[model samples]
Target: MTQKQRIDAFVSLGNFLRSDDQKLDILLDNASIKNPWYTKNNVRKQLATLSANLTPENLQNWLVGYPDVTVDQTVGIILAGNIPLVGFHDILCVLIAGFRAQIKTSSDDAGLTSFLMQELITIEPKFATYIDIVERLSGFDLIIATGSDNSSRYFEYYFGKKPHIIRKNRNSIALLTGNESAQQLHQLGFDIFDYFGLGCRSVSKILLPKGYDIAVFFEAIEEFRPISTHHKYTNNYDYNKSIYLINGDKHFDNGFLLVKEDERLASPLAVVFFEEYADLAAVTLNLENSASSIQCLVTEATIETSIPTFPLGGSQSPRLTDYADGVNVLAFLMDHATQN
Candidate 1:
């Protein structure tokens, strides 16, 4: 299929997802059954974000920079299942670049991506020839894989001979300059609580100005207390809280979430790690030191830092061009497409 055809099909699929379609609801239910993390609300939220990003204007803007070529190579993608529809962007990149996708969906997130691909084929029958959901990813010319740091080693060992992009574990963080408005801090709660902070883009840590009142931060995020209603989330909160209490570690807990002074970037679910900084220079130095482990940074301040920063609540709502791991996916695809 041509690029326009691919774009049109995706746009239609996005519209169908936004509509009150009973079939789509069933698909969401099935997805939740396969992975409890994929609750109906989280699935819908993810779909809505995907729908917004699939517009004709956005797709055109994203693909226009790449050299168009109709390369007939199979691209193998091993998707990550940490969040709902996590791997759809990779699939979109492959198909839009005029290549075939041989996908091995993460077992935790199998149903939704397949359902969406079938919907695309229904919108444009030609896409049926371009997409395949395979049990084993073999006979492919190149590979793109996402997993934990340990799994990345396995991927590098197995797929090392082929052209590949292997992504390891990464987490997002936020910087608080002690000047955020109450509204901005409230929205920052969404960055932490959305999808129960399962996504790599979710903010698991925050850097606060030294002597900043922690009470203000807690009060602003009070709206998210309902997140504790989810049993799985509550269990994590209770477990982590117990661990802290038993160890006699001093932590601030507001009954629903825990905030501790941790130097680590990746925090466990139901908890957010935070650190204090004296100034922007210290924050920038720390971020630069941990750049490889950070996926994105959320901040409202204009700090001079090399890390990618988004507004307080915009981490999860990334645009079409927000390639994961800071890799230029389109460029990688085009470079391979041009090779004879």
Candidate 2:
């Protein structure tokens, strides 16, 4: 297929996702029914984000740097099922770059992705040859796997010899200046609580200016208290709370969330770790030291750093150009295409 045809097909797929098809609703329903973590609303929200970005203009702009893939290599993608459709962007990249994708869907998210891919095939029959949903990935030329740090080692053991992009656990964080307005803090709530803090893009920690009243931050995030009602979230919250109380550890607890001092980047679900920083410079240094473990930053402050940073609420709303782990998948694919 020509490059224009492939791009046009994706644009059509985008438009199809935007439509109010009953089948789409049923897909979301099944997704939530099968996996408690994949709530119907969360699935819908992810689909909306994908549809919004998959436009003709966005597709053309994102692909302007690369030549058409004349080679017919297949990419084997091992998707992560932490949140709804987290692997869609990788699939989109593989498809738009004119490569076949042999996908091994995460068992947690298989049904939803299969349904979406079927819809894309309906939009463009040519894609049927390009997309292969497989239980065992056998005929792939390259690899792109996402999983925990431990699992990433397993991926490297199997796929390291091949051209691959193996991703590990990475958490997002927010920096607070003690000057954010109430609206901004409320917006940061999405970064912390969205998807019940399951996605790698979800903010699990916050860096605060020294002696800042943590209470203000908690008050602004009260709107997200509904997240506490979920049984999984409540179970995590209760377990963590009991542990902290039993050990007599110092912590701040709102009705639904847990906040405490933690130097680590990753936090447990329903818990937000924070560190009081002497200055932005120290925070920058610390972030630089831990850059590999961080995915993105959610903050209003424009501190000088190479790590990707998002606005208060933009953590989960990554644009089409915002690649995960700051690795441009398209660029990698284009470079691979030239070598072969």
Candidate 3:
């Protein structure tokens, strides 16, 4: 098979995972048995974006640029469980690049991704051997691991000898102009609360203008009533609230979620924080210092200078298609073949 054909296998797997008629809803129902973040609406939304973004055209472009790629190499991924199918992107990336995938799925998200991998094998049987689940593996040519800052230390020690992409915890941020319209602010709500603010890409904090009314932020986010009502989310909200109250820490209330005022990148799952900024230049410097642990940033106000940023609601739905560290995946894949 041609390289594009193999990449197409990855695209087809994505489409199959997203099929409305598939048992995804059922799987999500089972997941909700453990954590109620698997609400039908949220799962459907997640699937829709992931499925739509992996179009045949996009997949073809992804492989076409990688002319010398091989299908025999193996890449290992230690997936993260903080968000649904968070590591699926890396799985598809390696597979589409014509490499075998040694997947160590996070326990919280393994079932659904494993089921999808099974479905992929059905589409093209030979591809089945290219993917495997493992309790322990060491033969991989490249490793892509994601973990907390603590676990990253062990991953670095163990896999430091190999070509690796080891990701530590990171969170998204938002820049507010205070002049944002209600619609723009509402989009910000999705960035913060989607995935119950568990994903690294989810915005955990915002840089608000000084004296910016917290009321506006609350009013905008209240539109996500379904998100607030999810039992899993409410559990986090209540748990974090109790912890804060017990410790005598202060947090602003938005009825459903807590807003803490802090200068940190990541907040607890059910809570968000905001910091007031005096100047954009200072904010940029702070972000630069913290860039290693930062993902995407959202902003409404146009800056005189442009930096890395994403639209308001694009956090929870990055494509299998998006290259990590802003490097072109197809080019990198082909380079491996050329170098060898």
Candidate 1, residue 244: CA error in Å?
0.6
Clashes of each: 0, 0, 0
State in Å the error of residue 305, model 1: 2.6
TM-score of decoy 3: 0.91
Indicate the worst ten consecutive residues by lDDT in candidate 1.
63-72
Report the lDDT of model 2 for residue 38.
91
Worst 10 residues of 3 by lDDT: 321-330
Residue 125 in candidate 3, Cα distance off native in Å = 1.3
**lDDT for each residue of candidate 1 in 134-183, tens digit (9 for 90 to 100):** 99998999999999999999999999899999999999999999999999
lDDT ranking, best first: 1, 2, 3
Which segments of candidate 3 are over 4 A away from where they belong? Answer: 246-248, 304-307, 324-332
lDDT of 3 by residue, 1-340 (tens): 4566676676786677667754776777776665555555666676777777677886666555456456567888999887677777787777777788899988777376787788778877877778898878768987888898999999999999987788887788888878888888899888987777888778898888788898987888787876666776888888999998999888888768798898777898778888998887787787777776677778866653233577677666676545544555455555664666
**Model 1 off-target regions past 4 Å?**
none
Candidate 2 Cα misplacement greater than 4 A, ranges: none
* Structural similarity to truth (TM-score) of each candidate: 0.98, 0.98, 0.91
Task: Give the candidates in order of TM-score, highest first.
Answer: 2, 1, 3
The C-alpha lDDT values of all candidates are: 0.90, 0.90, 0.76
Q: Which of the two candidates, 1 or 3, achieves a greater lDDT against the reference? A: 1
